[model samples]
Target: MFARSLGWIVLLGLTLQSVQARDYRYSDAHLHYVDFFQESEGMDALLKAMDQARIDQSMISGVAVAKKWHEDEPKRPRYYAGDDADAYWYSATDIYVAAALEKLEPRQRQRFHPFLTGFNPVDKNAVAHIERMLELYPGLWQGIGEVFTRHDDLTALTSGDTPRANNEAMTRIYHLAAEQDLPVLIHSNITSKRERNPLYLAEIEEPLRNHPHTRFIWAHAGSSMEIHRHQTRLDFLLPTLSRLLESYPNLYIDLSWSVLQPYLLDEQGKPRAQWLALVKRFPERFMLGSDVVGRFDSLSEQLHGFDPFLDALPADVAQKVARDNFLAVLPKQR
Candidate 1:
């Protein structure tokens, strides 16, 4: 009877520990207030979701580019990203995001870290628009991006000149970001979906090399949902990321959901040793993000996905990845 009772006590203790681990409040480093089509569930729904998930803060941005919907087609494409037509500059996206932030009560507003994403990265004159927005809003804008450059599917459908992270236009924007002490979250895909290798490394690498002062948050660590659909898994991601982290002090990674599969977790849904060791070695460099678009209902599950990985980490390191690391990269004024 004493042995059985001791076993029950131990079981209860373990359960309580798991509950405690789940209770850690999160800071979402990557989130979108709208989608390519400009649809959203709006601010109230988002705040309620955040409260439910215990997400203390979030880095929110508008979808940088707009999707083109073809009116004449018999079967209309649901989103412009995959459609045959091209998407164009969507400068008003920033305004939509800013207006949502303004609608919030002061207490509610404090939880958001808004980043500007409406301007064209490939437009040389885009910097002037950003300056106007920053001047108009003053301290309201916290950062820049998920700047969509070299995105799969979206890249093909985008009109005018294809944007690259290393372009002269983007170079000017990086300079502006450094001047304002704002971190830029760029979504430059590491490789094309058709190719299994890191063929597009130069698009992201060139910018990182040039902009040492500007803190660059490599969105989804250069991986995306489209990449996964084509290749069963990315064999090159782990080594590429590890080497980049070692090479660039200004580079931080947004370990969003796309990166979780085949990298952070094994096929059996267990944490991978290579990933854990890499994160542990650089605890301060990694941040958690849901990368959820236009909706808040999935917020909790997205944040909870990190729990297993967190459990394997030491308490301090887990806490850092879950919260501190994201907050650390935000603009100092906040």
Candidate 2:
């Protein structure tokens, strides 16, 4: 499959004489811009890599990446890891989400996604706490998800068997987006995992299906982090994403970190061409993302930067993947 893809890629590159001209601000539609938790620290890592990749711009923001944390620790102290509701989580999420949009509702409308884990501040006033964040910062947060979910062992002992938060929050979040004509990005369960059930996704899906006008983008190819142990990755991910895409039109995907060699391989050690083919078939639904953390110096020469990947694309196709498609529907500024 690699040989076949390489042949097509080379031929595509050769045929496109204006590939260089296609090089411009490749607005990555999805980005974990700020490391509120300092856990993944993926925000800063992404920016540096973007510069190295020569990706001029991105629609990056802080995400509520704590679905697993909450489920894993449903008792005692909630662990809201990775900066969602906390003031010090990241620099500014409210600003980015409401940067250009006009009008934001008070309380429920402007609330941040709750991320309770072992150390969470308790549901004693979870919604109120998030409301306080919106009241104080205003326009910093958007919604939640890109929320982490996995089948790791330590978490297995703790995570919940049902959706954590109230459907009200999901409804309100959806209402807020509807009122403002915006989209919500959620972390849905794409891959089949008996150990980790993305029950919260049902909550999210309920609201999304009800409100047809509301748009939503499922991140990381609809497959969040998983305990690979020795399992085939794509064997599970591709079919899952493919099914979801087939199921929902409002549902979109961002090809964030899959550009690397790791994502292309399945549990059977076979090269999965389905993902690349999906992008080729539906360029508008997928966005380009380089999930490299830290700087380009982190991985020099052999891989170079994000450019070779973007550069390798057929010019017009790359442009669509880069920004145009996303910006077409996303809220953009100069």
Candidate 3:
């Protein structure tokens, strides 16, 4: 009885502390990830990284889950678009060559399905793939998207017949999330050279606007790497982010991948206080979004990692950036 009493006291004290810290590690939503590179059981890796970072919980989403529900997503198989090679947007594919290509060829598109070693859509041969993903991991995946708009070649998304079909299918999937009231973090970078801005269109913004409850997270903060990467200071992302944020109460931003080096640089290529302020101003509007993957050494570099980015934040800002702000905004988990 005495030991039991002692245990209760300790448990209560720990619980109180947990509440005090606001469990900053969790409640985070922007998990801009590379489903292609990271293992499917990404939550495990994420949780492990969070544990190290002392993050309590996280809101998660994925393309596989979204596509599983939205049947129109292009098949994981590889192929090529004929003729006009310049329109690589959805025309060509060479998994190994996507990085080498100057344009958005199918092969050069996102590796979400894995363009590096090999690529295959989530096993469609099996039972309802979407159901399997949900059953396989429930309560963990809060929403989906950040599902990059990529194709094996230009045709998968742009081919005469396919693009229309793809668009219709995505419309259905977006509605699915709306019905579920789950937020979606999508891979839309308005600033990339290879792709046109998604938000600039009416059809693309229609479903999301129609579904106000659904949240949207733009993975890249709307800036091309070549430009933002060399900044002396000040984020090129703010304009894009602020624009979206101003227009959509539900829109949000994530700082994943890129190691944030470009944003970290200043006019003369030096890091500065002004830079930190810009990055921090968006709390509750921003997230500790790390596309931290397994390929790199530091935790931030690890698949589903965030140590380096977390280390970059000021304590007060870090807490909010890491979790508080995200928690304040995420549509409550189902």
Number of the top lDDT candidate: 1
Q: Kindly report which residue stretches of model 2 are placed more than 4 angstroms away from their true locations once superposed.
A: 1-25, 36-50, 63-166, 191-208, 258-272, 290-314, 332-334
Best first by TM-score, ranked = 1, 2, 3
Q: Which stretches of candidate 3 lie over 4 Å from their true place?
A: 1-48, 59-140, 150-166, 194-208, 224-236, 264-281, 294-297, 300-317
Worst 10 residues of 3 by lDDT: 111-120
* lDDT (CA) per prediction: 0.89, 0.46, 0.43
Query: Which numbered prediction scores highest in TM-score against the true structure?
Result: 1
Q: Kindly state the number of residue pairs that clash in model 2.
A: 24
lDDT of 1 by residue, 189-261 (tens): 9998889899999889887888899999998899988888888678888899888889898999999998888
True-vs-predicted CA distance for residue 313, candidate 2, Å: 5.3
For every candidate, C-alpha RMSD to the true structure in Å:
2.5, 9.8, 13.4
Which ten contiguous residues of candidate 2 have the minimum total lDDT?
A: 113-122
Model 3 lDDT tens row, 1-334: 9999999999999998655533234343444233332223333454456566554544433222111112343443211222222221211122222222223444322212211111122222212333344454443334554444432233243323322212555555556556655555554334333333333334335544666666666555544344334442233444545555667777666665443555644335454454465566655666755443221123433313443344455667767766666556544542
What lDDT tens digits, residue by residue, belong to model 2 across residues 1-334?
9999999998988877554444455655555433333334333444466566555654544433222334444443333433222222222443443432224344322222211111111123334544565576454444334433322331233233322222444555456555544555554444344434433445445554776666676656655444243343445455555665676777677655543345644445344466556666666776655433212333222123334444545567667766676565553321
Quick one: how many clashes does candidate 1 have?
0
Q: lDDT of model 3 at residue 43?
A: 33
- Residue 12 accuracy (lDDT) in model 3: 100
In TM-score terms, candidate 3 sits at: 0.53
Residue 38 in candidate 1 has what lDDT? 76
